[model samples]
Target: MGRSTLRFRRPAVTTRRLIRGLLAFAILAALGWNSVLLAAGNSMQGAKKEEGGFEGEAPTAILIEATSGAVLFEKNADELRAPSSMMKLMTAEVVFHAIKQGDIKLTDEYHVSENAWRRGGAPSGTSTMFAAIHSKVPVDDLLHGAIIQSGNDACIVLAEAMAGNERAFAEMMTKRAREIGLTRSTFANSNGLPDPGNKMTVRELAMLARHIIQTYPEFYKLFGEKEFTWNKIRQPNRNPLLNSLEGADGLKTGYTKEGGYGMVGSAVQNGVRLIVAVNGLEDPEDRANEAKKMLEWGFRNFEVRTVFAENETIGYAKVFGGNTGSVALASHEPVKVMVQKNGNDKLIARVVYNGPVRAPFEAGQKVGVVKVWRGANVAVETPVYAMDSVDRGSTLRRAFDGVTELAIALFRAGVAKL
Candidate 1:
């Protein structure tokens, strides 16, 4: 027999890595879609609540049901105003984001920069997390000082530790605030310094607070700390509500020569959670009183009704390919509707989607939507998708499906050309 040579080459490392990365990407895409379907069902869309019953509200005031991000009442919720110390909410957000990314561990020590000391201990700084220069402060202590004590010194130390300098870190805070829908906000410093350009709306501040509390529940309790010590100096929490209000868990307070008194307050009463942010007040007492009244009004007037629950199968979808012909559809979290004391109970909960999602389906793939309507108007329309996977079909099955799909496409295309 004549000698024959056949060469076989194994896949290159890059090819293997690409395949692995693509597979991982696909898996993540599926899971993310599933999460959206589960959460998107909880949509609350309505025309701006009409000039609420209450008035004389601060030039800027907002009351939102925390769990559902529903605005119960507002005068100038979206109007731009200085966030005051409420800007720290974003500072805290950046710090938390670093902690999560592992860039700065909770136990990591932060070095105190001279600029940090000046800005934090500046004669202008209302709350100072006292820190001496050339000292290594643990991450956890810095966080407590910034959150509980509203210490500027502590904030700068954290900013420097996380971003090399306070000014650079403040830019990070501004970027994150914008990403989270705080469109009206501009940050000039790590702390809420009084500058013409640095400002935010009560609505935006409330939204930021809600995001931190919800996304980082583990570290959120740090906001509720009553007292904190740094450099052996202990300071009491300035938020008076934490002591008197039931379920008055946490939040932050702010004061400045130009900004007057301002606060972003959160509370939970009777299982109902609320966030209220106020600014441009004349005094601390006024700020506290205004927040309390706003929260009380929200609790007394609005109520939450669950329209769908997570994992609760809303319907099934026809899926082509893989091991099954049909896949289940469900929300990851409960869907809720917040309404006035006596508004509309006749809400129409409906699901709509194109039939038979084609295969290569991943759990949580968005294939359709759930829309909530009150008579002729849509209360909210939440996008939804598949919550599980449907692998490629067998050769024979795929051939049959291809023929069927071709026929359907031809019919649809012909009609559209009409």
Candidate 2:
């Protein structure tokens, strides 16, 4: 219900340059403050290239710190475009989830139907594992083929075995995508061949890649394999990052006449992992080069800094009719962000919740989130919870609080009219 700005005083910085840069900042007020606000800046789409910021060649791209899911840089990251082969990441996630849930096993074998073979196999004139028609292949081999070789046939066979057909499987992919926080991505086929319905933003793709890396570490290593051999035929991994970037690991790549070139990539350096996604590039070399550049730049420029410790009271949310007027909020996990090591960058951290919440809530109940921004992009966000239980307040206290809220609402309305 209230917002305030906190600025960091850069040591020995020139005032003229500081004024021109106008970077945002966040500083927690003294403990027991009821309300505080953090500044908001331009969205990534509108943020201009600063003096030291990385400018990527891809039209849509994002770079983030994997541990904290912090946005280091982004450019048109939410604009949806044909995902091409990058949609395979969704397909892989579904299979991994099914396996984890015991609905399927790696040893399970799926039939290579004529439809799968003819459309996505050797005869399809597309990327294929040369899966023979009527062959029964185990899920393990299929995953290897799909991931290491970008085999369309392998994806179709798994799709048919799992959900009766690729269409139904695509629906499952979209559903699972939403469950994992990929809200804007949609799927039309198992292998991401070409469909108007298959679209994703680079931001979601990066998030998906991070999810796979973190949730299914054992399965994710398949993406980094240099080669996969099946039916006596061998093919190399399609992701260029593994070969080009040091410490680069698993992920996927895509290209189409309509979608251009795209890829999702990750790497670890100094124990810090970073995820990068790029799309809408005109050339394959540009796609590879741009992704590589972004990853290297992130590793070189950014470092994680703890903003708030675990169980540290971050701020308070107003409570209606509780034992007290407000509830203290804190995250079970330490709050962290990725910032430039130079300490020249500014950030904004805010406690966001809809309240004064009507209480009688238990301690540790999730109430809201702490969102921290670096420039215009959200650097990190983590959920905050009630630090202690709040029982119903006395009747007189409730009535007084209600009257106070009513007065505040009326004042806000009058101000709006003015």
Candidate 3:
């Protein structure tokens, strides 16, 4: 199932200023910042929201933690639909990954073919880089053709140039998509030109964008360049949100009669990167504005505040059958909350698990659940794992229980030998 966004729109200055003032007073008073922030406000402007599924109703929309692949929001994230030019992200990503792996070169040139030049309007049609047959253009130009201009001909040329043929390269693409954990995508062509079996979900596209950006930082500049020129032809980027959305960087745009307007866009604001993908849009500009609105709403509303550090003792867990009476409970990672900038303290944290816990636990094994709450509802529930191993009681001697353990161990050892 997909999930709804904890999304809301509000002017940010008021909450920010309030948080700032509270921080200053806390510093001067030498008191806790979290305590002060919690004590001060009672506003919903910064309150936690209810999360719900977005997968069933919409075709596919997903907002993800660009770096972590942690799904922040989603709508039918697994459904396959026309990827539009968003397919070019994969095309570009494949080429770049190849370059990074030394499979091709920056200056390598390819001869354009007639089939590439022949792709024109719908029924397996769309834009062109105006690339002509027999023209020996560099891989760099073909890159622009496939990406900036959304050129089908350029895509085919690059595919053929990198591999012996486009079909081979597309197979490589699907293989790579699976390797990158993209379960909801399949590629039938190098270009995003609508094909009978070609489709991707919004989650897959965003995942591709995040991976390409993070995994190939050295090559990301290509997507940000506003325009490119080759063989006396000029091509501008297709993503309209590049300049229209403040802090917007690079992403791809797509449109086929069936896919409508689609975009995979990201922006960096106050050091946080937010990526949003929307398909089934009615028009190009409509998708662009929706992207901007969603991004602005996200950036404006949230700011992270730490409540506890990893290994910081949250409380003590009472062990049921262990040498120690209690184990120090803590978060495995920093416990932080995304609260409205200046909003009041509606956030609460509670740790729950099976009482204390039985022994035989290992370090980092989850033993309890941490539910972050806002007022009456839970905001997020994450597991709190054992910070260190809690060995099982050694005094007990069992025949059947020990045999079960021995069998499991022997089975694993045999599998390892095989």
Best by lDDT: 2
TM-score of each: 0.72, 0.86, 0.67
Q: Is candidate 1 or candidate 2 better by TM-score?
A: 2
> Best candidate per TM-score, number?
2
Model 3, 1-418: lDDT tens digits are 1222222223354565565556445433431122122312223443334332223223567765454344555677677899977888888888888888898897998887766666631223467777767778788777777777777888888887777787888888998888888876888888877786678988788888999889988777777778877657787887777878777778888888888888898888777777888888887777887777666766775555566667776655655455554566677777665555546436666677665366767777767766666555444555676666776654552343344345545545644654
lDDT of 1 by residue, 12-65 (tens): 545655665665565444323432232233344453545245564477888777
lDDT of 2 by residue, 219-273 (tens): 9999989998888898899888888899999799999888999999999999899
lDDT value, residue 181 of candidate 2: 89
- Which residue pairs overlap in candidate 3's backbone? 15-342, 41-344, 54-75, 55-76, 85-254, 360-392
Ranking by lDDT: 2, 1, 3
lDDT of 2 at 133: 98
Candidate 2 Cα errors over 4 Å, as ranges? 1-34, 37-49, 412-418
Candidate 3 global CA lDDT score: 0.69
- Give the residue spans of candidate 3 off by over 4 A: 1-59, 120-125, 307-418
